[model samples]
Target: MNAPFPPAADVGVPVEQPMLVEDADAVAWDQSTDLLVVGLGGAGLAAALEGIERGLSVIAVDRYACGGSTAANGGVFYAGGGTTIQREAGEDDSPEAMLDYLRIEAGKVVSDETLRRFVEQSPETVDWILRHGGKLAASVWKEKCSYPPLDRFLYHPDNSLVASYRARAKPAARGHRAFGRDGKKAWGLGKFITEPMTQSALRLGLVFHRYSEARQLVVDRDGRVVGARILSTPEGSPEARRFAKYIARANMLLAALPPSIPLASITIALGNHYLRKASEIEAKARFSRLIRAREGVVLSAGGFIMNPAMVRRYAPAYATGMPNGTLGDQGSGILLGMSAGGATALMDKVSAWRFINPPKAWAQAIAVDRAGERFVDETVYGATMGEHIVDYRGGVAWLIYDKSLREAAFRQARDPKLVPFQRDVTLLNLLFNARKAPTLDALARRIGVDAEGLVRTVATYNAAARGEAQDPFGKEAVDMHPIERGPFYAMDISIDSRFLPLPVITFGGLRVAEESGQVLDRAGKPIAGLYAAGRTAVGLASQTYVSGLSFADCFFSGRRAARHAARANV
Candidate 1:
């Protein structure tokens, strides 16, 4: 038996210290609200909106500008089980099938009840978003469901991989997306929803404090969350501090010479003098404002994908990748909750996406490992393929295809029925990296894989493509085939691509109750008056994340937490 490598130390992410009420009796309180919502992205916006709708005073803060990764995502919400659009389109769907599929993909991280609620109430959530100016062009439905929760309202294929793993779930496309200018006008992504949400929250009277980073949760001696301590820089001219004393001396003489001075000039001079004194009193000013939440504090700050320390401590595979998160996604919220005794889970799971499912041109080719052997089902989920390649195949692989298949795909490029919209982007980019050679051996060497192994794999696959034998990998030969024809084409598709690097996100976070989005302590008890939602708290995507699951969890959990916090005891 062989021994394994010793595990690395938990060089954890940095988090600010919590302000104890007993220790800080002299700090000035800047704002007091019923609910304090941290972060201004999808989850934080949702919480602030819910708090406002419930008639609770709300103050929301963001470390940077608004618009987190939610605005810049593919924007498909996996709503299944005969949602309003599915029913209107007369697409057959059942909650049973959705539950089966989701249970398989989601594994055991989410409680059945919460997953069920997410599936069932999704229509309501969609409607709520729309009512508040969000958009979803549900009138259009595609054949294949992109992610899980099988229902035909979306546009992607069934989960054959899950079924191969022995989970009996029917296939259906269940992604519901907003309408925007990004794709075909019918295929809007996350921005269509997140932008309207931010606008609505602002219009509904929620106080939004931009560029204010929450450093710590304020807890009382009894372990109840009272508010938050935010780190911010005062928004003023720096020149005022430089000229304070000069203005003060001029103001002192202004009273004696004011008879001939204009009123406006006097007012301006007096304002500058006060600013000067204020600057003197606040030299090298430290702006740490205290925000008191009368009822509760909802930590909706995003996940820690941008923080290298957190990535190193948790999922080191995610330590390197193109981040799909806001700059403020520094593990602050998760660390804050943990410092308050919150427990966490699935911190090691991450999404390393290499979108190879499209251009179906790539599908006709086989992804070969260093040994020149096919590793995964080409038609399987893209992220799963990414996992296999990164985890098992040395973080790189090559896709070998023939000219005939490429020609076929090029001919069908304009046919929307045969190809997804905007897949040409990948196809065009691939042309720059695609390599060609006369023989399989020459091509294998050119692409840097094992020539002998490539010859064997190609010869056997060619025989199958030519209808002489069945494919060992279960690939149908209708569109793919026969490397017997000369002029072979191969493209390197791996965890790293200079033109189009693989993007990733971290989904694990602070553990919370299945019923409410309350932050849970290490002892598994709720931290009084402290709640969390979005990627900052573990939810539906605790095990395997898909396109819209994070957004859906944010909306649902945000509403749930706000509902509980609005009426909680101070």
Candidate 2:
């Protein structure tokens, strides 16, 4: 079939991919290297750099730019198994503990071999990042937080939920943050990762082509992914606009990204800030440039968080919340893996919203459903609340607080004990959903809940707070406080956060082999010359989440795939 738009050749690019071209007699490869990488996010960067460190020729490309979703994130890399950082911070964590903890999160899909590799190779992966421009500190945090609260505390806090898991490993700090410069400046965690990784790729002499889109995977008669079709065009062009949809419908047509035009712009930064302007690093394309992968192709292009169709199909409940991914996370990577007979797992799994922890003071507040009756132990981590609300309350719940609790919430918002929080959103929630009433009945009427039920719930809670009766929900006394004082308030801290959506990322995608990071076929076989990493495949957070686990998996899976791919043809 002829392309609707006739394409032309992009200049100054050589053909480099590790597979045999079907039409080698007639078609000329735009660029050729031992390894051709698509997507320059953390996974892609890690993959490219891993190949380079092994002295293999490498070329990498991204649809938008080098930095994908990671650039916009608070880069948290989860690690443990007695790493130097953990040791320095005076925390004892064994590999078995990390495996135990992760097994619960990843569930049954990931193989035991993969879990072992993931736990065993984690420290080496950290070392690789450190050597190649990344930075992390060795300090155990003292407080319990969803994400890093005060630049310390890398491991998961000993949450009561984790304690209940069948694996039953004692909680330890494992999330590693990159503060960039001296490792003390707490700013862009993504930059700490993207900046260093990008520069390392450039320094290692890997060819980088930005603004080049991989439209489809080139398959030979043998039904294996050989290379990608490269297409270079304007961002909002008719073809580019329809690319994602077109790719999904006809997955094969989407894998290949042809060549592109020259001299647009190449922006580089040596550190946290922009270093200086330099020459343009361009990838010229004439027609859809067909560059064969001599070894293999990796899909680390992120998840489908931004794709409403995928969200609605997999998890309908999350269709209307704030998506925590970039414009490029349209599931092209997931689809690409699928198009090549790759079986996917956990597509239905998503962290629709993560409440984490709002404030220590708010722990004493009572959370109620539409009927105005307390259901959850409000003392649990905020991040853990979303699932319960979705399963039981249909995604909407209210946090009812007394004046003391409300005032403390405000204070904690201003000056958090563990981490600086978003005071604006907190205020917005209080200002909008919160109700101030002289009595529990009036507050219930104002908040649209059962008046009698609200009054009864409060009286029971107050009695429990006063230690007159055994607490019905097992809430510790430290988390108990009476709502006897009038002028009560309520804010809808539902899964959607009524005021603001709790930021969340999808944690499931294509299931790849743990040992090789190879994308597996539906029948549980490795497709030769094909692999996946990061959110593109099911890793670290196979289902549930632990702050930095996904990011750390990005680096580990990328490095793992590259380590195997670099040796695939040799």
Give each model's whole-structure lDDT.
0.70, 0.68
- Lowest-lDDT window of 10 residues in candidate 1? 1-10
lDDT for 232 in candidate 1 is 59
Question: Best candidate, lDDT-wise?
Answer: 1
Q: Where does candidate 2 stray beyond 4 Å?
A: 1-27, 148-167, 181-188, 233-287, 373-375, 416-421, 450-475
Model 1 Cα shift for residue 393 (angstroms)? 2.6
How would you encode candidate 1's per-residue C-alpha lDDT over 1-570 as one tens digit per residue? 011111223434445566788633455778889899988778888888988988889998875556665665666666777777666656566777777788876758888888888878777787788788877654554422233221222454334333243247765556665556553422225778888888888888888876567878898888988899886535444633334344345434432221222363575466556645644544454477899987888888888886667787677775556655655577778878877778888787777766564566666678898788988667666666677777778788888887776775566455554324334545565567678898889998887899999989988877887889988766666535576666888877776655445567887888898787898887789988899999998888667666677877788888989888866643
**Can you write out model 2's per-residue Cα lDDT over 474-527, one digit (the tens) per residue?**
777766799877688887766655455655567777778888989888888998
Report model 1's TM-score to 2 decimal places.
0.80
Against the true structure, what is each candidate's TM-score?
0.80, 0.80
lDDT of candidate 1?
A: 0.70
Residue-pair clashes per candidate: 10, 53
- C-alpha-based local distance difference test score of model 2: 0.68
